[model samples]
Target: MSQPRAGHAPVRPRAPVIRRAAGSRAVALGVCASEPSHEAGAAAVARRLALPLLTSGTDPRHCTRLDALLCLDGDDLSLRQTGRRAPGPVRVDFGAAAMRHRRAGGHNELLGRAVGVGKKTPLVVLDATAGLGRDACVLADLGCRVTLCEREPVIAELLQAGLTAAARRGDPWLDALLSRMRFYPGDARSPRVHSDPAADVIYLDPMFEPRDKYAAVKKDMALLQRLLENSPVQSDAGQLLDWALQQPVARVVVKRPIRALSLGERTPSHSIAGRAVRYDVHVLRSLN
Candidate 1:
């Protein structure tokens, strides 16, 4: 196999926050029957998953990171391209077989009959607090064009990595779905809502201030919170809400746990109750 023609940085693993010694080992994909493309892909997968290179084989000293692994048969790490942009050889989709992340089902209670998503509907979703692409993925799967605006580069890289790996595997459903989930890398307290980004609906999933001292956050959530040290802590929810109101969206829906209060002083147009959280829909005509 040959290398791809795109650029997507590797997804740093959440653990082992240290890079291995320079040239710790050599990695190779058999070329006797392997195409040059497979080499590039296998390398890329190692980087995306942050897993050791060729755990099943010896590590090489002269390697440019396996952009992908060529399949001798069916057992190999395929790679995925990140998105539509690239200036050179896109890494072979390596992290193709590793698809562990999935959407959280807790939001269903909040999505009760929310209008705006449907076939061919021009919906621009602003995930003001795109902690991860979980909710964003759900929205994309539901046919809404979602812009995942994330400020932290690390987590942003994770999102890109996950999305890339998904795309690389020729995952028909996920690829088709993520094709519509835009990733806006930066703070969204006041996002650069594209000229037509605002939609009939907007989605906000901000991290709330923990109400109890004894409540222990999940390890993954805690890790993410650590990665996003300066998130909403300095995020001006009121300012964000104000800015969102100026967008072209018709409704702004906020995902809040059952206990969190409504955002800012602005009252919601209405509220929908799910099992554990509330979806506060603030109806707006248009913010063009």
Candidate 2:
């Protein structure tokens, strides 16, 4: 809940223009009226996103011009692709996945090792590119205090909603993990983030052009890529890498696909290579 310092202003990026499909109709955001409890929340979300609330019996299937649909389904809020063949609804579930990863012993995981999680003292990690917050959740579950910075408004909203739901579950262990996590609403490249002295390590996961032609990308990731493609929010790998290297943090970790080149043509001090991805560790200073 700590706010960024006074002099550190947030970078105001251009707002995303919601695109419409071929037809003339506009995309709508709505709740399933059968679940009346979700009406208020849905309405608020629609208002914030500048989307219209679809009326009862509004058949999304027939809305060929609609590009996307944000719906409150029971206890979950989801964004579904309507006009084209989108992978699936984009939502975050931290409870089950976090617990599973923790139970599976993540100390040996490449990310965990790269982030120096098994050290004597708990590390504070700033996940600068916290897409979906999956990695942040895993790091939190492994006893790291994680500050997740998400620049995209829609993705940030979904992450906040997911964390809220996870906290309400009343699971002691989950609550403990959630307590160690924080959300920041600004670009990772913003001065607000770099000026903060709390984090011991900064993590970057810059999105690169998809190289998988023969293999199917995960549904959630595919959906995320599609949404990002249409939004004004973009990741500048070179700039992010440059800023991170100059930070006072003990180390900077960059996640890259195994075969992809290093960000900005700069190599890490060392790297942990996996079958599909690699964690490039840049040691600014020793944590010890």
Candidate 3:
């Protein structure tokens, strides 16, 4: 919304490119026609993703060769694997995570510590890679004003839909929490993002190559990894980190697997480790 800072050009949204697994058939976007309420949504998604709508009565089970199905079921937009037991839709849930954070005393956890939550005043966080918005929700629940940036069009749509659904639930706490959050549909690396003065901390969670193939993988994560497999930006951690460093934020926090390699060549100012993940904190200026 603000003018791009001098020498920084506004970045435009790139056309969506649908990638499927090798040997997989073309995927389709469709609505369950029986659910007329979803028709408009499905049509819009089909146009955005550049996919054909599935004909009514075509059994989803028979589309085995198809890579995936972008389905608008009621108000939820989900990418489901055709012919497989539908992995649950990726949804944002602040309630459970918020409860856990509250039980532990919000912002006392490793993630909060890594984000400099207790310093000076209530922090404003830019969740630069808001994949499903789980971490963003936790931060908002902890009282930070969080802005989410999700570049991938499909994933952004899913997040928007999920957040809309959550708001409609009319739960007072959830409504108030949602009010503190905002969405920006653009790449975090875009100069437009760095020009924003609101973010006190920039959080990066670039998708990393999976090291575990067995029981550790959850269905939702597996689906997300599959979708992001061919994305050039998703695989380039160095570039993402470099962009974060250039921002004027007070700190940058990157989430990585506990034993995974550091994101970029620059060493972190400090790191907070948990059982499954680690947060690499890059201090640009002292929050204190």
Best prediction by lDDT: 2
Model 1 residue 182 CA deviation in Å: 1.4
Over 1-288, each residue of candidate 1 has an lDDT whose tens digit, in order, gives 111225434333232222222323222222111344343444454454354334333222223343222221123322221123311211212232222222335454246245345423656677766655677766776666777776654455446555655666776776677778766666775435464355566677666644334334553354343333333235466777777777666788876666667877578888887766677888786432
> Per-residue lDDT for 168 in model 1?
64
Candidate 2, 75-117: lDDT as tens digits: 5667676554565677777776544565475323878889998
Worst 10 residues of 2 by lDDT: 4-13
Error (Å) of candidate 2 at residue 264 is 1.4
Give per-residue lDDT, candidate 1, residue 204: 77
TM-score of structure candidate 1: 0.60
**Candidate 3: stretches off by over 4 Å:** 1-34, 56-59, 93-108, 194-197, 210-216, 232-234
Q: Among all windows of ten consecutive residues in candidate 1, which has the lowest summed lDDT?
A: 24-33
Alpha carbon lDDT of each predicted model? 0.51, 0.69, 0.68
lDDT of 3 by residue, 88-193 (tens): 5554445546444553653347778889877856688999888887788778767887888988766776777667767767788778778878877778766666
